[model samples]
Target: MTTESLAEPTMRVRPGWTVAVVLANVGVFAAWFGPIQVLLAKQSEALAPDNKEFVFGLVTGIGAAVSVVAAPIWGAVSDRTTSRFGRRMPWTLGGALGAAAGLLVLSGAQGVALMLVGWCLVQLFGNAVLAAQTATVPDRVPVEQRGVVGGWVAVAQVPGALVGTALATVFGGIAVGYIACAIFVVLSVLPYVARAQDARLVVAPAFVLRDFLRGFWISPRRYPDFGWAWLTRFLFNVGNSIGLLYLFYYLQDEVGVPDAGTSVLVLTAIYSVCTLVTAIAFGAWSDRLGRRKIFVVASGLVMAVAAVVLAFWPTWPGAVLGAIVLGIGFGVYLSVDFALITEVLPNAVDRAKDLGVINIANSLPQVIAPVIAAPIVKHLGGYPVLYLLSAVITALAGVLVGKVRSVK
Candidate 1:
């Protein structure tokens, strides 16, 4: 279990098809989230309207909420799907197509409701890719190799978020940003479908909805570390969500940076470049070291410290430094945390479904954080309080991660 011994397996862990799936998401995100609406005055006016911040928030929430249901259902569907391309591939392909359609719909959305509907669809079917893809780590990769692949998946986000954010900001147009995101999503995933071998029918059981729901409770109680792992994932993502979801707004409010096209591009470039490099390095290093929890703990602590710095300082320089810390911490966490989860499953038989439950940890916290954050920020006064609160949650999350002794 020592780092040196662990490192060999983790590093040698071929990403196989999972990395390809991650790439598809990158492309999809770039197209959907990227700036696609620069050309249309009407679209821009509504999206960035003088008085529709609430609407925008609502649209976003709707999108997030839609995924709650989508994720589980997609996981179930993949569980049921027994196809020639493999269960994961069919869903990955279908999810990509759904994502493409969703983006196309979003491109044409004319009103708040239409926008919400389009984004909801995108969030739902678009995220189906995750249900199929995440299970691949546990299903196919050796436990030791999981960390390296997780790193690959995590680093993929650099292009996924940064590239898309850049396109959206630079284009300053609605339709173009969206269409571009669709393209990115498709391109990123193609390699995964082509290269990854179908997982042999491993321990993952055939789907039975009734048993699956029961499996959630049965596994955690039976496997001590699985429960802790899920808790840690949820808490970690929650803390991370607070920092990432709000970073841009913090820049605008704290530094008084205008939300101009130029400013956004600069920020995305800086953030993406720093984060991508750190994320990939740390992910690989963690696998080599054969220690995932320490990195997870380190990620939480870094984020907490960055939150504190941002809370009190609120200057352009301070924000930049915070972003750097945040980037490194988050990148490492995203890259390696999945490895930790894969290590602790009760048994391999339920890998997909069990992993599905853990996947909820990633999604659910996203739902929980903004609801808690926006209210706290509103009541407590400003970005400082939000940062303070995020820091505390992050520290707590790090502690929860320590609860897992069995994973090692």
Candidate 2:
């Protein structure tokens, strides 16, 4: 800890910085990941329909798999970096620019191979910022204030997703939609780069692959709550992604919208409004309650129950209602879980890196679930089975979260 940090806590500095980081994440989400959500859902319809779903899933999975593998190395690098601008800001700026370029590449993709390459780049470059971003909280904020910090980060997600959704209508279609998103990423990184306090900590590189590769072999048994946190994250993302992957489709197929363009706008609006309302409330509450595990477990169970309702009745109202309830649960989970992870984190010296590692559990399930869902839908039946699977898997994730005994 810095000597300045050791002085009696100042109300002015920390909260503002934390809020800036959260806003940056909001910007990244709106501009970077938001545009891609629609493409991920609808791309198969245009690009070799028979294989598009599976291919998209594979690309995302492979990229996410690569992320889990790579985040620690990037975190380690950031930990050691001593750039003029600050360790984290330099990484964030570079990653944001790289991600913007990746989006342009993805926008121009003509075939599956090119698209996959673009997607891979997005995961690698974009997360370079994300790793640094997540780590900054640990480096800059007092450990005790993590819940409030996490709340800020959680609140950022809704606007980001909503911004992307808004672009479709304003920009007119997928092509212009993605272009608008790129604008958001660029804008989001600039303030942090400009305002980010120059961190004085010195970081030095460790040059062995074993340093990064060894984490997988380390058992969470060593950290009792680690397994629970990881599994809950996995289950939550799986169920969430399955439902999300179909939002654009559901609006068209179920809502019977006349214009495809309009459907995109409608879904985005609904998603944004729902998310904004719930995430704000739940995120703030979790911080106040200081009971992360119970909130997470309850959220997961609620999610599973909502999934069951949707699975049985695949109508417009059912889907919308399910989306509302599911959104509430997800909002609660999303708002608090990361804060929860920060508290139960296994190692202090490696706090940011471990949180990044656990985050993989969240994304990996996303990659795995859709890869499995595509085939089941194309051949076995349709999204019903996928919904059921999502419910079962997510409920299992709740059970795992129940296993966590620390950090509550």
Candidate 3:
């Protein structure tokens, strides 16, 4: 396929294409989330037992900061690419390989500085893969089918995170765990890279420096739907990130789980199952109904309720319940919200760039979560207060999604 044919993707994407996209997402997320969910914390503890939280937060915050810059830049570059092999393919393959290299660096790191470098590399390249892959949805799939397809793509995160965590846990040693994750990252992405029928850009766009720089900023006043969509996503992720970032510590410090690592796996399992059930189902339902906003609003509110459950109850049973609720809410939000965002995009030519900008909502939370969460968790009523704050933010996200007038 060529870029000219995909001006407004009108045909249904084949099932094979959807499967490849889902698998690629699973790999990208597995590489990214594995460290976030497990290995990074262990490394931080190993390096600085007394101040592990600070180390973990700092490392992750800086890495996410790198992602904030890398995603949009890579997206813009790919937009202008004229590679015969296809604009997204080279980056998709290159990014996966680069991320694997980063994981290898992480595997060998004996100190915080090296750990920080490795993680930053992973985030930088991982976003390259993500930005390119996300653009493909709007490039190939019709608007009507996006909810169902988006649901399948969004749900990949559950398995990706679970598989990554499982690998980290099963490997036992820090170095070996990192190695295993790196291997999976490379293997899982290969199929998609090989099979993808990416739209090839025959002619590169002229690069006028001033215009190029200006293109990155989509005016919120002019593009209100995009702005509202971005804000709601940012708010939703802020709640989600704050809630999940310190879960390992939460289990260890508050719940007093026997094996914190294994407990995380168990909780994630429960979360994954619930997410699996609701993600595609709700997405398909929304596609049938031809509605997006209602599902998004309801999901955010449900997520808020889940956060409240965690705040009020800190027991094992409470954690399980929280995971189930959160999974259901997140599944719905992720699927429908993705389809909604694509519909509101300001330019067909800039799909990757716009989505990258939207992705800032996803990555920025990682940067902000640790900065805010660290202070709150340490001095401001600890986990309960932190979780209450999560509930409030997510509920606000639900309410604010109503402002997106373009998609309903």
Query: Which lDDT values do the candidates have, in the order given?
Result: 0.67, 0.68, 0.90
Off by over 4 Å in 3: 1-6
Write the residue-wise lDDT of candidate 2 on 302-335 in tens digits.
7887788777887667766776777667676776
lDDT of 1 by residue, 174-241 (tens): 67777766776777678988886664333334557787666556455667788888888787777766
Best by lDDT: 3
lDDT of 3: 0.90
lDDT of 3 at 26: 89
- Listed in order, each prediction's TM-score against the native is 0.86, 0.89, 0.98
Residue pairs in clash, model 3: none
Candidate maximizing TM-score:
3
Ranked by lDDT, top first: 3, 2, 1
Q: In angstroms, how far off is 266's CA in candidate 2?
A: 2.7
- Candidate 1 to truth, TM: 0.86
What does the lDDT read for residue 9 in candidate 3? 82
